[model samples]
Structures are given as C-alpha cells and as structure tokens.
Target: MDDQNKNLILATVLSFLVVMVWFWLFPPEEPELTDLPPVAEAADVTTPSVAAETTSTPTTTPAASETVAEAARIAIETPEFKGSLSLQGARIDDLSLTQYREELADGSPIVHLLKPVGEAEAYFATFGWASAEGIAADQVPGPDTIWSVESGDALTPETPVTLVWDNGAGHIFRTEISVDEDFMFDYVQSVENTGTSNITLRPYGLLRRHGTPADLKNFFILHEGLVRMTDGELEETDYKKIVDYDLDPREGTQAVRLEATENGWIGYTDHYWMTTLIPEQGTAFRSTSKYFDSRDLYQAEAVMALQTVAPGETTEVTTRLYAGAKEWDAIRNYENEEGVTGFLDSIDWGWFFFLTKPIFWLLHNLNVIIGNMGWSIIALTFILKALVLPLAYKSYVSMAKMKELQPEMEALKEKSGEDKQALQQGMMKLYKDNKVNPAAGCMPILLQIPIFFSLYKVIFVTIELRHAPWIGWIKDLSAPDPSSIINLFGLLPWSAPEPGSFIALIAIGIMPIVLGVSMWLQQKLNPAPTDPTQKMIFAYMPWVFMFMLGGFASGLVLYWITNNVITFIQQYTIMRSHGSKPDLFGNITSSFKKAPPAKDAPAKPKNK
Candidate 1:
C-alpha cells in the first residue's frame, strides 16, 4: 500500500476501534427478569418490639396504600412541582413536575415524579421514627397510622403544614412539612414526651419504588436507578444490582449500607428526574439501599442517629426531600449553596466527566445567551474549532507540504525501485529536509475522537438537551433525527424504522446525509488515491461514518457536520496560504472521470 493509503487505513481503523470498544464497554443495559415475592400488606409484617437502642431487625415495611378511600392527604404546591402528601404516612408521594412533561407536544401530561403506594409501579418517600425503649412500636407511628392536620390549610411554598398524632400515652408526634419554590421539601419531626420518663428514637427517611419504571431508557449513557452521595464519595447502583445482592439477615432484604458522618444523600434517579433524601449537614446517618423480594420494592434510606427525649422535653430532627426534574442549575445550586456534597455528580457524568462537564458547561452557557440549544451546539463547535486551530493549522500545513512533495516522492520511489527500506529512508530524509512531520497529519483526527465522544456523552446524558429543539421537525436534540430517508422525510405515509434497528442504520436521516456530504467535500481538497484498494476505502469511508453515526443524538450529529465544514474551510485557507492551492473543484470533477494509466518506461519488451 502507498504511504497515504497506509495512514488513511490506520486512522480509520483506530477511530472505528475506539468507537466499538466504547460501545462494548458501556453497552445498553438489558432489563433483567426478577422473581419478586408477593407484596405483603402493612398489617402482615409484625412491628418491631421496642428496644433500648432502637436497633430492630430491618424487615420489609409496606408503604401506606394511597388507594385507601378515607386516607387524608396534604396538598403540595410549588412553582416547579405539585403533589399530595399522604397523611397516613406523611409520604411525599403523588408528585409531578410542572415545568416538564411526558412529551414535547401540547396536551402531554406533566412529568410525574412520584406515585403513591398501592398504585402499580408505586414510588414515594416517607419519614418517621423507629421505636426505642419505653416507646411502644405503635407509639412511634407505623406506615399506616393516620395523623390529623394541626396547622396549615394547604401546603405551599409560603405556607407550611403540620400534622399531629398522639400515642394515648401523652407522647405527641408533630411533623412540620415545608416546601420551597422549587423541589426541596423540609420535614421536621419533633416529639413531646409529656408522660414518659424518657424515650429514644431514630428518625428515618425512606424512598421506595415498587417496580422498575415503565419508561426507563435502559441506555448505558444515562443512569435511571439508585444514586447516592456519601461523605464526599458518590455511588450509583442499578436496580438489577440491588435486586441481585445477597440477602442481609439484619435488614431482611438485599441491601448495601454506608455510614456517613459529614454529608450525604440517597435517592432514586430517573433519566431526568430524581427523588432523594438529604440528611441535615454534619449529622451522622446510616445510608441504606435495599431491595425487598417480598414486595418487589427498591428502597433507599437515611436513618439518623438515635435521640433521647426526656419527660416534658421535646426533641426534633430535620431532613430534606428533593423531588423534581434534575435541572442542572438547580442541582448545582444545591451542591454549592446547600452543602449537599457531590450533589452535582448525581447527574451521570460518566467516565469522561472532566471533558463532558466543561463541554456541557460551555454549551449550557451559550444556550442561555443564544436562547436555542441547537444554535448553542453550533456555537460550541465553533469555539472548540478556534481553540484547536493552532494545532490544526500545523497539521494542515504539514499535509499541504506533503502534497507539494508528491512528485518528488514519486521520483524517489522510481529511483529506489523495489528496495522498501531505501524508499522509507529516502522519504524520511525528504520529510526531515522539508521540516515536515508525517505524523502531524494524524494529530487532528486523534484529538477529535475524544472530543466527539465527550460531546456525545454530554448530549446523551444531560437533561438540558432533552426535548431541546432546532428548526423544522428537530424537536429533541438528545434523540436521533426523526425524519428518515426510508420515509422520504415524512413525504411517504409510513414512519421510519425505530432507532438502533438494522433498518434505521441504513435508512439514515438528513443530518447524517449532510454529515457525509460535508466529509466528502472535505476529502475533495486532495486527489483520490491512485491505488485501487486505497481508492475504494477512501470512497466508502464517508458514507460508512454517515451510517454509523446516523442513530446518534442529533446534537452530536450537528456538531460533527459543523466540525467537518469548519475543518474544510480552515484547511483550504491554510493550504492556500502555503502556496499549495488545493484544486478542490478540479479534484471533485476528476473523481467522476477515469484516470489515464501511468507512462511506461519506454518499450522494455522489444527484445524479440
């Protein structure tokens, strides 16, 4: 193979291998079948007997049924969220985000963040006290215990609600639930020991989901299960992992527990939403994630240190619940301002977090300034191109010099004849004499691979890109192009095949076609290879890339198209400056014409 063909093949193979390895390492996760035991009612499990230290066997606790006809509920209303808190367990369930929806189209339902218990696929958060010595199990308030409203008529950002329950023994339990304008909910639980000598109890917060969400994307790029930040370390566990864990006899479930002394939070994170328990800062707590086989329930808990309340003394504990869409700014604020350690990491930044984070930050700020995510992506591509221009200029200059030396190189090959070593040495000497680096041509391609992967990660994983729109039929930048060549871009009555399907791979969309065209135009700056194998590989590479990236997020495809166009402009300009004016038009026209064969070395076969 010729030198150009060899370098081309090497670059193509390396790029393809990197992409394949990335997908193999982080392939789409398949939903595993779980044989969950039947769900037991709250009445079926025996309440733990009161102990001196409040250390009771951690058994499966059924959530209070929302379907109960007479169960009272406290209404929750915020600028960004709306839901009802079940009075039976005071669980912050039945929540929905006002800012987002199930679909981008009008009339689509708001994104429901939590569902009440007893509903299929029920998910919710609950807070209560675990019983201690001198405190009956019933006195601590079980999941099914009803409480009466003591203060507010309705719960809102400005008005908080207080619920009160009495244990007949003169121990009064009061829960004051407060909400901010956003998703955070403050639950302050206090106990007044009027008749008891002393009582010890542990305040615990639990978030439970009965089954996997029906709309889980299951894509490896996004995490849609358990996420926690413990003492400056972040952990993410999938539902399958929690379900497959070995049964813990003490918890009577499959669970993982961590002890955090400084700051921590635990919750279930969906693609764009999350429900987490944020313990008070500087408080030591036991963070536990459990999957109960009996109820098919996945639960995360923050059980705070035990507290003792003496007679006529009131003891209180405060915890926070976050339930809403995972807005980038909101989560970052909570991390920086509210002291939720590593809260921003709750968004699955993946292994390329360093690149993805900064890239997304720039893209996000640009979007804010431009007021359009698609334009923001285009702007980001331009900024990145400018940043790498110096390196790209050097590389392109080297390639132009190489092109200028083509005739000399051909002459050297002829002089050296079949001596491969002499030919290589000659080429190296020529390169050194010209102060050119043959390897310099590979730098741009190598740098782009990681940047492309990082951008893909950001577009796929960040909620900010979800449902972001560009012009004309491109409503969701995070998703593949909806218009497909198979359907003639909606001209035909049929729809395109589903993304990731074999058919969709071949029946790519307009963006990928444009991507291929941009790459093809870029290739036209140089002449097609003379060797047949080299010609064939170069001919198919652009379209191969087109099909390969056809199913990627539109935002990423947009970036690729933009990059190709900018690179073409930069290369053409630089090559012209180097006095090696690329015959782009001539090369493109010549590509359609048959090439004349090389001139023979004057009649060598006339000996006869």
Candidate 2:
C-alpha cells in the first residue's frame, strides 16, 4: 500500500476506535426496569407504628385506599407550574409543569412532575418530624392525621398556605408552604410545645417514588435518579445502584447514607426534570438514599440534627424544595445566585464536562442570538474550524508537498525495484528534504474526535436542546434524524425502524446522505489509489461512515456536514497557496479510467 492509503487506513481505524471506546466506556441506553422483583404496598403512615430511632419516617393522615381527588388539597399556581399539594400529608405531590408537555404534538398533556402517594405511580415530596423518646410517634403528625388549613385560601406565588395539626395534648405542628414564580417551594415547619415538659424532634424532608418512572430515558449519558450535592462534592446514584445498596438493618431497607456537615441538597433527577430537597444552608444534616424492597419505593431524605423545644416555646425549621424543568438558566441561577453548590452539575455533564459545558453554553447563546439551533451548530463548526485553522493549514500544506513528490517517489520505486530497504531509505530522505511530516495529516482527525464526542454529549444530555427545532420535519435537534431514506423521507406510509435497532443502524437518512456527499467531495481533492484493494477501501469509506452515524442526533450530523464542507474549502485554499492546484474534477474523471498494464521487467540476462 502507498503512504496515502496507509494514512487513510490509520485515520479510519483511529476514528472508529475512538467511537468504540466511547461506547464501551459509556454504554448505550438500556431498559429502565428489568428483572423487577414483585413489590408489596408501602407501609401506610396513618396507623401508629414504632418508628425507627435512627431513620426518619414520613407520615400521612389518610388510608392508602383514599384517592387523591377525595383528599383535601391546596391548589398550587405559579408562573411555570400548576398543581396541588395533598393536605393528607401536606405533601407537595400533584405538580404539573405548565411550560412543558408529554410530547411535541399539539395539545399534549402538561408534564406531570409529582403524584400523590395513593396513586398508582406514587411520587411526591413530604416533610415531617422524627421523634425522640419524649415525643410519641402519634404526637408527631402521622400520615393519617388530618391537617386543617389555618391561613390562606389557596397556595400561589403571592399567597402562601399554612397548615395546622394539633396533637390535642398541648403540642401543635404548623407547616407553612410557599411557592415562588418558578419551581422552588419553601416549607417552614414549626412546632409549639404548650405542655410543661420539653420535647426533642428532628425535622426531615423526604422525596419518594413508589416505582420507577415509565418514561425514563435510561441512557448512560443522562442520569435519572438520586443526585445530591454535599459539602462541595456532588454525588449521583442510579435507581439500580440505590436498589443494590447494602441493607440498613435499623431501617430494614437498602440504603446509602452521608453526613453532610455544611451546605447540601438531595433529590431525584429525571431527563428534563428534577425535584431536590435544599436544606437550610450552614446546617448539618444526615442524607440518605434508600430503596425499600417491599414496596419498590425509592426515597431520598435529608434529616436535620435533633432540636429541643421547651414548654411554651416554638421552634422552626425551614427547607426548600425544587421541582421543575432542568432549564440551564434556572439551574445556573440557583447555583450562582441562590448558592446551591454545584446545582448546575446536576444536569449530568458527564466525563467530558469541561468540553460539554462550554460547548453547550456557546451553542445556547448562539441559538438565542441566531434564533436557530441547527444554524447555531453550523456557526459553532465554523468557529471551531477558524480556531484550529493554523494547525489545519500546516497539515494541508504537508499533504500538498506529499502529492507534489509522488512523481519522484514513483521514479525511485522503479529504480530500486524489489529493494524494500533502499526504497524506504530513499522515501525517508525525500520526506526529510521536502520538510514534510508523514503524521501531519492525522492532526485534524485527532482534534475532531473529542469535539465530536463532546458535541454529541451536549446534544444528547442537555435539556436546552430537548425539543429544539431547526426547520421542516426537524422538531427535535436532540433526537436522531427523523427523515429516513428507507421511508423515502416520509413519502412512504410506513415508519422508519426504531432507534438503536439493527435496521436503524443500516437505514441511512437525509443528513447522513448529505454527510456522505460532503465526504466524497472532500476526497475528490486527491485522485483514487491505483491499487484495487486501496481503491475499494477509499471508495466505501464515506458510505461506511454514513451508515455508522445515520442514527446519531440530527444536530450532530449537521455539525459533521458543516465541518466537512469547511475542511474541503480550507484544504483547497491552503494546497493552492502551497503552489499545488487540486484538480477535483480531473481527479473524479481519472478515477473511472483504467490503469495501464505493468511493463515487463528489463532483461537481466545481459547483467548475468
């Protein structure tokens, strides 16, 4: 094989290896729930039971049979959210995001964030007190204890609601729930001890999901389970990992616990939504992520240090809950302004966070200014090319010199016929004299690998890219190219193969076809190799890439197309500047021409 063919094969193998390593390191999406053991109903909180001394238990006032609609509720109305809080446990459960939806189709149901406890897929956030010796389990508000609304008629951004539950033995528990225009909720739990003796209790916040969500993406790149930031460190645990945690004998559940000495938060995160408990800053708390095998329940809790309340004295603890879309700006604001440490990291930036974060940031700002994500991706490609233009220029110049030396190389080969060592020595001397580096062409390919992976990560994981449209039939940039050629770009009545399927891998799309065309055009800068094997490999490389990346996100495919076009323009200009004109049209025509037969070896009889 010639040097050009060797370089081509090396580049192709390296590119393929990089992608394979990426998939190996970060596996693809898998089923959300598999081999799920049958689960029993969660223990009802209404009846008085001996609560564990070390574990915090959330109690409610109604039986499990009661429907959410039958229970008294405090209506929640905000600029971005609309839902209700269940008065049965004063749990902030029934929430729906007014800004988002279940699908991109018109009139799709609003995205439901939380559900009441008695519902089929019970998911909700509840706050309660864990008692010590003096405070009886019944004295503390159990799940079955009914609470009456004391202050507000309804819960809104401007008007908060206060719930009051009296133990009837000189102990009163009051919960004041307030909402912001955004997704943040403030719950101030205060207790008044009217009896003579002092009582000790610990305030705790718990977020529970009875079963795994049905719509989990389950993708390796996007985390959809427990996420917590504690003492400047971020921790994320998947549902499977949490379920497999070591059993906590005291709690009788699989659990992982952390003692957060300072600032910390704990919650559950979905693909585009998250609900986290933000305990008061500067306070120490015990954080726990538990999976109750009996009920198939996933729970994250922040239990504050125990506090004592004297007779006639009232003690109050304030905690915040965040439940809404994982918008970049909103989460960043919470991180920067509200001092939620590493809140932005909760978006699953992955191992390439350094690249993914800034890449998405620039793309987001470009989209805001340009008003199109697809075009923004194109612009980003241009910017990246411009930034690396110097290196690319050197690489192209070296390639141009190599092409210029081809005639001399052919002459040397003929002169040193059958002498492999002499041919190599001559070739090395020729390259040194020309000031060309054989490895220079590999630079551009190496540089693009990380950028491509980072951009793929950004498009796949960020919520800002979710449902973001570029143009016709491309309603979601984050999703795979919807226009498949197999269906003739939707001309056929049948649909394309499902994503991640074998058929989808081979079924090329319009973007992939465009990508193949761009690559072929770029290859036209040089003539096809004379060797049949090399020629075949070069001929099929573009189509191979087309099929390989056909199932990738449309935005990434757009970037690849843009990059190829820019590279072609750059190489053509630079090669011309180096006094080597690239005959693209001539190369295309000559590719079809047959090679002349090999000449007979000169007679060796005369020398013998």
Candidate 3:
C-alpha cells in the first residue's frame, strides 16, 4: 500500500511483536516443587562395565581376577561413602558415611553419602582416565595400580584411607565395586600420592554426580545460598545438581577438561550444607575437570594443591565424602571439624554487586512483611509511584495551562496551514509568552522506567513468590496463567493462554481497553496541534499503548489502570472548573472562554 499506510501497519505490527515478547519474558509467577529424598533399594548387584570384555585382559589371572571382582563388588553395594578411621570420640564408620539428611550451621541443606554413580563415572575422564580403563565387571585385573575388593566387610573395613607425599608427587589409585538393593551397582575409587615437589598432578580430583534420569525421579534445582561482599552486595548461587548426567552419548562430558592455577583453589557443592573434605590440597589441571550445563543437568568439579614439602619431609591428605540430601543444622557442627568447615557458601562477585545488593535487601525485607508476594509487589509499586508523584503533578499542571491557552494555538495553526516554519515560530512564541514547558509531561514518565525495571526483578527472582497465591483463579502466582486455548475437536473451548489466569487475564484484557479508551479521551480533551505528523502520532498513541500492555504483567497493568483512572477523574474536574467538555483527541479548544487571534506571523508580499 502507500508509505503512510505502510508506516502505520508497521507500527502496529511492531507494537504487537513487543507485547508478545514482553509477555513471554515476564509472565506471572508459578509454584516450585520441593526436592525429594533419595530412594531406598533392595539387592545390590555387581554390574559390569561396558568395556569389561576388552579391558579385562590385564587383571585376568584367576587369583587376581577374584580379588578385583570382590573389590568391585564391595564398592558397588554400599550407597554411602564410609571412612575407615576415627578422630577422638567419634568413629568414621558406615553410619558416618551413610546418606544422612543434615544441615550446616548456616541452615543450608545437605546430603551425606557415597559417591554419586554418575558423578564417579564422570570423574574417570579427568586425566583421560576412564571407568573402562579401570577394573570392569567382567574384566580381570592385572598387577598394576588397578585392584579391587568385594564383600562390604573387606572394603575399607575400619581402616582410614591415607596419603603420604614428598612435595606431593607420584600417583596411586584404589577401587571397590558393589550393587545396592535394587541391583544397581556403583563403582568407587580413591587416589593418593607418595612423592616429592608438593606432589602436584595435572589431573586432580573427581566429584561424583548422578545421571539426569536419576534426578528426574528426585532432587530439585535451587541456589544453595547467597554471597555477600565487602561492598554490601549480595549474589545468588546454585550448588545442587538438577538433572543427573546422562552416560550415553553424553552431553554431560562436554566439561571433560581441567586447568591448574598456582593460586590453588578449593571447590565444594552443597544441598545446603554438607561439603567434601580435601585431604591434601594441590593446584593442577585434570583433563576431565570441566563443569557441564546440559539440557536438564548441572555438575561441577574442583581440585587444589596442598602445601609443599622438601625431600624426606612427608605430609598427609585425607578426605571423606558424604552423598545424600543436606541436613543444614548437622553440617554446621563441621565448622569446628579442624580441616575445612566454612566451605559451602563461596560465590563470585563482580562490579555490579554494589548496585544490586541493596535492591535485594529491600526486596527481602519487603517479602517478610507482606507475606503475600503479589501484595508485596503492589506495595512496592505504590511506594515508587508516591515518590514520583511530585514530577507527575508538575507535568499535569503544565498540561492544564497548555489547555487553557489552546484557543490561541489553534488560531495560529489554522492561519498558517501552508507555512510550516511560520506555524512553528508562532507556536513557540505562544508557549514562551504563556510561560509553558512543552517537555514537562515527557520528563516524569521517563523517570519511571528504572523503577519499572526494579519491579521486574522483584517479581521474577524472589523464590518467596514461587507458587504464591493472589485472590481467585491464581493458585500459583509464579507460574503462567492456567487457561488453555487448545482445540481438541471441531469445537473451540474457553481455553486461555498458558499464562492467563481468569482474574489476571480479565484484568489484563480489560485494563488495556480501558487504558486505550482513556488515553484516546485524554488526547481528545488536550490541545490539538496543526502539524500533520504530530497529529498522526497523537492519533496512534492509544493503540500503541494497548499493544504494549498486552504482554505486560497484570500487576503493571493494574498500576497503569489505576493511574489512568485517577488522571481521568482529575482531568474531568479540571474541565468542569473551566466550564467546557474534555475532548477525546487532545483538542483543547473547549477549555477556553474566548477565541484568540492567529499567532502565525504574516509573510512579506513577493514582487513579480
């Protein structure tokens, strides 16, 4: 079609697109599911590795194979990691290692148990080591570092695994395998060093993680805790694995590499509190030391170098791992455990921390008082609106004065229809004469944008709002509206969109119409300009706003709707005082008592 028509269509389309995108980006809240506890099984079986037949050649001797098989069996059977020794009155037994639901002193949740099946297997990739390279179920063990033990009684039976090193050099690894009650066997391995030069190795430690399939049946994804910096900023960090890593054609293995740094690092993940111990810290890179962010899974691995000692000087590294759900309070006792206690809450912070932290604190405190998150949001909006009301009042007064002088403006516009420059000059002169500020209305609205952004963060990230309720038909405020629009047969049912709750949808749908109409009416009552482009812009403002609101939060719409209703009432009052009707298209002619002369300047006559 024509350029003007095309421009109008384009504007409408652009408005519609923005609305859909905003709706998708910032929809209503939904409830989150709680983390489930680990499941109990019946019989522990010794399952074979995929490469058992091919890799078993080394440990194939009858005696060696038997020993290896037994070791594998013991490791697979126990679901919890048990240490064989004790310190003081407490004994490090299977119970200490069993999957215990304990909390750290800081009140974070944690699970203490043995290595996660998926995580243990993933660790094999560090240093290019593979589970297949170790002893497999059907494979025979050789006379190398690879060895195995079967029965539960034989595997670390009351014996603490220890590390001895001269500068922490050389490498040694041991293993055991067994199945659980459900016939699911897990493989376990321990690595140590007995050398010098601080015994720093390229491939460091392994952190066991569960496969995604296992996670689907249990566990949830949530930030383990928050971190505060010296600058008073706070950050949210996640330490729990969501979905378990997949073993087949694994996207989980993408983080299959590692790097070493001289600074030395300590890494730990918690359900909320339980943290792994570092027997001997070492700074080194392990090829399989990468973290993965898969479709539905997350896992992290960390390693560090311990203190260095000269030749003839010896040091020991001993660590115990507990795998299970977190018991926040119980783990707190570990803070005094001597080795490492304040390990789970570490998080990274950058420059933005200072700016974002107070915002979080404000939101946090607000959450406590309002109990209902939706109401909390309303409260926040009211506070912000109140703060900016002075600027809005200034804008409103300016608009009122502009309406009072519309007669003079319209006379100038009609008199200078053909002379654009003359018309502008006349308009400016009138504005100057009347001491009006044309930009007054634009300034206040501009200041409100940042507040809007802050509100978005409050609604989107606060876990307190997850599954929160707001009046009727909105069982979960955090989730999208539950109304559906699917057509099963020939009939169209009353299905709303996924994020459209009956109340919210009604509010959302109705507010915009009201907003649009109110806006149109406001425009009509205001002074009209002679510039065709200006006229066109004012004409399209209501439609543009409507489409923009289509994707806005019902709460945001509620705010706008309230603001508009108030303004409409205010404008009506202003009009009655002047003894005239409010125009629907920003025409301010009726607000005045007398028509003024055209303000456009007369052009000089041209000689032929």
RMSD of each predicted structure: 5.2, 5.7, 13.2
Against the true structure, what is each candidate's TM-score?
Answer: 0.89, 0.87, 0.48
| lDDT comparison, 1 vs 2, better candidate | 1
> Which pairs of residues have clashing backbones in candidate 2?
46-144, 59-143, 60-142, 60-143, 60-144, 61-143, 61-144, 61-145, 62-144
Preferred candidate (lDDT higher): 1 or 3: 1
Best by lDDT: 1
Q: For residues 67-131, could you state the per-residue lDDT of candidate 1 as single tens digits?
A: 35358788888899777888877877788888898987799999887876556677778888887
Error of 1 at 207 (Å): 0.5
User: Model 3 over residues 434-459: C-alpha lDDT tens digits?
Assistant: 66776664544456554544544434
lDDT over C-alpha atoms for residue 293 of model 1? 75
Which lDDT tens digits does candidate 2 get at residues 1-608?
24664767557765785875476356656555543332222352222122444554444333444444566887888899888888866888789999888888899998988977545677888888777757887688744446889999888999999999998888999999998888789999999999989888888888878778878777766788999998989998888888889986645567787888898999999888999999998889888888877667787888887878999999999999999998888889888998887889889888889988999899989988999899999999999899998887887777766665555566666777888777777767767766768677667877887898899988887777788898898888888887777899899999988776667777777889999999998877643443446668777888777876777788888999999999999988877776676777552111221222123222221111
Worst 10 residues of 3 by lDDT: 39-48
**Candidate achieving the largest TM-score:** 1
